[model samples]
Target: MAADEPTGTATLRDVARVAGVSPSTASRVLNGGGRAVSDDLSVRVLAVADALGYVSNQAARALRGQRSGVVLLGGDPRTASIAAMGAGMEEAGRERDVAVSITAVGPDAETHLAALRILRGLRPLALVVTSASFVGTDRELILAELEAAHREGANVVFIGEHDYDFPAVRFDDVEIGHLVARHMASLGRSRPAILTSAGHPAMEGRTQGFLEALAAAGYERDAIAVESVEISREGGRTATRRLLERAEKPDMLLAGNDVLAIGAIHEAHEAGLNVPRDIAVSGVDDIPIARDITPPLTTVSLPFMEAGRAALAMALDGDDQADIHLQSRLIIRDSTVPA
Candidate 1:
């Protein structure tokens, strides 16, 4: 050890000072940059660095590159689709030697933006945002922040529909809706109803496609009832009860997701109405519980995990202009057909 070297763990600054050279010069020698420096000065810096045990900091290396090899995924981790997506991202990250960090963001835009801000401090190489639709000022604010991050060299990728000109991995929500409506029509269901929440752009797209396909099957938009409710099991139950009480009831109920479909089925059983016998029910998102219920639920299976893998691939491959479209398929079960 050098007589003047400090006893504790050494830093680059310490090594530079001991060697009587600028930090930049020491950094060039240590990193083996092509920039020319005196051979004698390089040797002195290397000796000082070795004596001080000054190791390179990964975080500092990232700063020099302007971003780290860490990918930040922002979404609601509790959701099944999000969980699957995280799994896919983690798998791909392991293969690529990149670190994937998942941050839970709230449904509201304010909370979502706050999480994004915190993750930005890490200067991740990519930011993969999987969130629901945002509107009004919230939408503008979110877009602005994302654009700013892009300008700052972070790859911004969205996992859902944003309708904006950005790299995205989107599910074929309209096709999912079309599939459900076509299946119901094949079952000879005439009267149809939509049960979903407002402000969900993807769900809205599904509803629109479902309505269009149903129209082709001889049911007009005015003939079908559409109801917007909170996205919860209780909300589905309450809405189903009200629909059942109407003078003219819908023969088919298409819910936004499986949880609501489960609720609808429960409410129908309480009313002594046999699912698919008196009224048929269906939903999107083929969650695990969808297949384990009394009568399995008929819903669409979205490729969330594939989407996650693709998102990471896009970031790593530097495909910032690519818009990848993933497909969804209908899972047939007894809920929409007679068992």
Candidate 2:
């Protein structure tokens, strides 16, 4: 090699050294790229970079070559649905050679706008919304903004039951309610109670479907008792206390999910009610912990692993002609039967 070539190149480390800060911190400020570059550092870093003639490495700037594919999953942080779906979606992505990322939409969070802002910098191939409903938090006018992102080139997939422009693979919550209700009724359990948080769309759908089935069976609303509470185990305990306060408590209890069902089971024991003899119990979503309880919980089950695979398939095809409502099942166990 000829020794005549000039050695007049500057690196990011040179800029950091001049700025008297770490190289990573300098990069963060400079790469903020028109976003909110937290004030003082932005000015200081760029100033020092310019003074030292630190040019960004174009060779290293080739990002597309380094990535195969990326998928983003968004959901409400508080819900178990997010954890369940997030696990399945990520596994699906890994099977297909795609890197998966997750973001939780904090309470009253503007997910759509935040996602859009995030996308301008990183180009993920698709986005999966992990929950059924997002309360309309119109912070900084986010809903319209996310809608624009969907219109533009983003592939959007909703994880639960929804009717939207985006393609979704959802479980049928309505059918789930019917399955559990019919199971209880067939067991000759005349008085059935439902417990849930009405704010969640999935829970609401379950309640509606359960009530509809009862109406078909000649039972009035009063006969089909219901209690509304936060969709938590503690909330279940409290709701159970309310039911116990009544002179005539239900013989069958249908909890919205395994968590509440587990709590209701505890309450039933506390009240000296022998399960299935005094009161029977059922739940939905056959969670991992369902079988671990004293008498394993009977539940309306969903094939979530299959749903995960299908969601990615739909996302890749980018054609949603078929709104696939995957079937749910009633898993019979000791809780709803004579032990």
Candidate 3:
């Protein structure tokens, strides 16, 4: 064959011929069922397939009672946490020789329903959801679709809390709250204020745990103040300003996430209050930006990448009863050092 020949009409036979392998070997390697093949041979087969522009025939695979070897990951990719989860899923999918398809959608009932409808048409081997809030309000429709997927031998995995019956990779938000609060108390910061988002399960759980721990540490109800905000940088800044204007200012501010914590720090600086001096700040989900900010943030670290990998494993490996609980750890930074 000419080197410049068109590959638009390429087939598995063409790939096998180019790679010096049999058609069966090419099929096994390309279709992802040839785990016993030598690494060098597998690499050569994949490279040849790419050079020949060979694409798997999903229809033929389905006719042969085999799955399409695709996994669907549904969530908003704009969020930092969800984006990290997507990256993890993609890495795992590549290792398993499975294709990953992402469907970006908003966090609303109608949007989730629409995304689920689109997902059903794909008939993927599994569906992984990084956020439960997207499907929170339309549980009935989402659950029905999940049941149908289950009946069709497709798996469903959730990365966060959900009321549905699917397997989940959950973070210990309550425990993270307790850890952060206990750490703060250990630093002798008794008067603490919480800045959190309303109607968010993760945020609410963290707040509840923190308050409970503080109460147990001999802090009275009047000494602690909880404020609900938008769970954004601006929300943190605005809420912090309000807290600082009070007759009695809090000694520490606990934000729902790093973004809010950054905002709180900015506000404290504007007010000329030295961090860990006049006031201290802490947050959850030790995002990348947390460490880069001035006077690095004290926060709880959730295993975002591990959660994604676990969710994909549960779905692809058919571990329906798998309830993976990831532990969160407290990371003390310069922001929370005792004066």
Highest-TM-score candidate = 3
Task: State the TM-score for model 3.
Answer: 0.80
lDDT of 1 by residue, 214-233 (tens): 99889988978888777778
Using TM-score as the measure, name the better of candidate 2 and candidate 3.
3
Q: Model 2: what TM-score?
A: 0.73
The digit string of per-residue lDDT tens for model 2 on 1-339 reads 111111135566666678777765665554433244467768888999677666444222333232223354554544555566656665666444344566655445555566557763465556666554354444336445546656665567777765556677878788788888777767766777899876677888888878877667666777777998876788988998888888787888988888889889999899898886889999998987788887899987787767767776666556454767788888999998742
- The residue ranges of model 3 lying beyond 4 angstroms of the native Cα positions read 1-43, 47-75, 135-141
What lDDT is obtained when candidate 2 is compared to the true structure?
0.69
Model 3 Cα lDDT, one tens digit per residue, 1-339: 332122357777788899999876776688665686789999999999888777665544556555655444454566678777776776666555456666775567788777777767767788887643453456577678668877887788888766568888998677888898888877787578999887777888888888988888888967788888876799999999999988889988888789899999999999999997888899999989999998999998888878777777788888547698998888899999774
Pairs of residues clashing in candidate 1: none
Worst 10 residues of 1 by lDDT: 1-10
TM of each candidate vs. truth: 0.78, 0.73, 0.80
Q: Model 2: runs farther than 4 Å from truth?
A: 1-62, 65-81, 110-116, 133-143
- Among all windows of 10 consecutive residues in model 2, the one with the lowest summed lDDT is 1-10
